[model samples]
Target: MAHPSFSLSRRLRLSLVSLSLLACGAAWAQQAPSSATAPAPTPSGHMLAEIQVIPRPAGTADDRYKHVDAAIAVIQASGLRYEVHGLGTVVEGPPEKVWPLLQAVHQATLEAGAERTLSIIKVSSGAQAGGPRVEDLVRKFRN
Candidate 1:
């Protein structure tokens, strides 16, 4: 996962550092304090999507983030179980709800004034009535 050529903002850098620290701490779980608690259990029969929206700025120096906010607003009102992270948002719900929500998020970003926007989404579903959830995968890395 070497990406030495890319430049990220200070906020993004700090967030990455914070996430790395949490992961490193999890790797040393044998020494974790007894008071540490695991993440809540995952809800069953849902799909998962981790999404990031990249909206083209007005110019080389523009970073107003109006478009980003627009996309998040749509997600916020989606009535699904979700968590907003530094790099992306994790959303979980039934397939019927999740798919359209993602589309609306992308469209909202573009409608917010981005000449073009890119939405990177990673989706996962399980074969059984239930599947892996946000809490299931990140429980080890979260308290």
Candidate 2:
């Protein structure tokens, strides 16, 4: 049951459900009944993630961009496989390195003088062994 104080309109509920299905499709979505194959064992700590850092520094658009750049610089220096997309930067590595790298990237924005910041991230890992790779998902799309 939903919280009585937090009810969503029917239309909004449907939209949220749709979005949830898309977000979880690879990991948790229901699959068609099949007997030929079984799911892989639990994932390793390897990950592929997209991180979006929004720095709200007291400054003009260019200044805000500079803060974002600061965060990207941290990403660039980490030496992880990464690609800067329009909304976020995608990074791939083992969890040990990626976790610290995420913290450093978030802190970079504040260190660059952002009053406050918001970071959004989406992380996924392969079902089998080995670290996830950005190329695994986007290589075909790239061409």
Candidate 3:
């Protein structure tokens, strides 16, 4: 038979091991779920508007060309696309950042002689992974 002191020590060790395991489990439970571990909420995708600028009172072809070139340069710096669709340029970026930039661009263009305010056409944000992009269903499908 085990000595009483030895039995007590063994019981303490087992209790310590069990407590350690429980503590570790609690820590893991408290951690926020990551993309790889959690299910996404949205499935397809979201939309962003691309503002089209048409400088009406450009005064001359050179002024119009300059306005378009300046807009393209801003879009390029912002890491967006510049697509030609007959009338104006189409660029893409996150709405939160892009919309404000679009407004600035529109304001600048108008001050430079544009007759009308910029027109924004809805465009899909394509797809992204995790975060707000997760709200986009298309991103989920891509994954």
Candidate 4:
């Protein structure tokens, strides 16, 4: 007759080994290097958002100027980036604050004659070596 305790011990050992292997595989998968197209990190250690407004009817030179100026004013007033053409804007702060700001900007741009609004969430490169940083604009404007 086999010992019941021995059987139980064997089962427990097998379970532990199986669990460890699964855990290791998961960790390895997560640690693998991501492709360039992989998602970027947000400014708040979360996902980032990029908003772009393309003018509707493709306004004239003066119209373009006015539209951009109005949008810029709103962005400046909101204390966000006026330009996010490159690595994109970096809005770092609490989500509570950032969420509202993003929403407000979205609404405001749409109202400013934008045919469509493009919003992207990704990581900020934060300027680059020997290049301008997102903070530069703030410093330049002294805001």
lDDT of each: 0.69, 0.65, 0.47, 0.42
User: For candidate 1, lDDT tens digit of each residue in 1-143?
Assistant: 54665446633642321132243235544344334664444556678887777766522346466777788889999989888786778888998899999999989977878789777787777777666556555656675
Model 3 over residues 1-143: C-alpha lDDT tens digits? 76775577544432221122122234434555567655444333333344555544433465535554555556667765444434444544455666766777666666655565444443445457322221232222234
Q: On residues 1-143, what C-alpha lDDT tens digit does candidate 2 reach at each position?
A: 87775457633422221122123334333334346653333346778777877666423565636787888999999988888765578777787888899999989989988889778777777666764355433333454
Give the range where candidate 1 is weakest over 10 consecutive residues by summed lDDT: 16-25
Q: Please name the candidate that would achieve the greatest TM-score relative to the true structure.
A: 1
* Range of the 10 consecutive residues with the lowest summed lDDT in candidate 3: 14-23
Error of 3 at 11 (Å): 90
In model 2, where do residues sit more than 4 Å from their true spots? 1-45, 58-64, 126-128
Ranked by TM-score from best down, the candidates are 1, 2, 3, 4
In candidate 4, clashing pairs total 4
Steric overlap count per candidate: 0, 0, 6, 4
Where does candidate 3 clash, by residue pair?
Answer: 43-137, 43-138, 44-137, 44-138, 45-137, 45-138
Model 4 stretches astray by more than 4 angstroms: 1-49, 57-61, 80-88, 123-143
Q: Quote each prediction's TM-score.
A: 0.67, 0.64, 0.43, 0.39
Candidate 2 lDDT score at position 60: 51
Cα lDDT tens digits for candidate 4, 18-65? 122222234434553447443333343322234443333223456633
Q: What's model 4's lDDT at 143?
A: 30
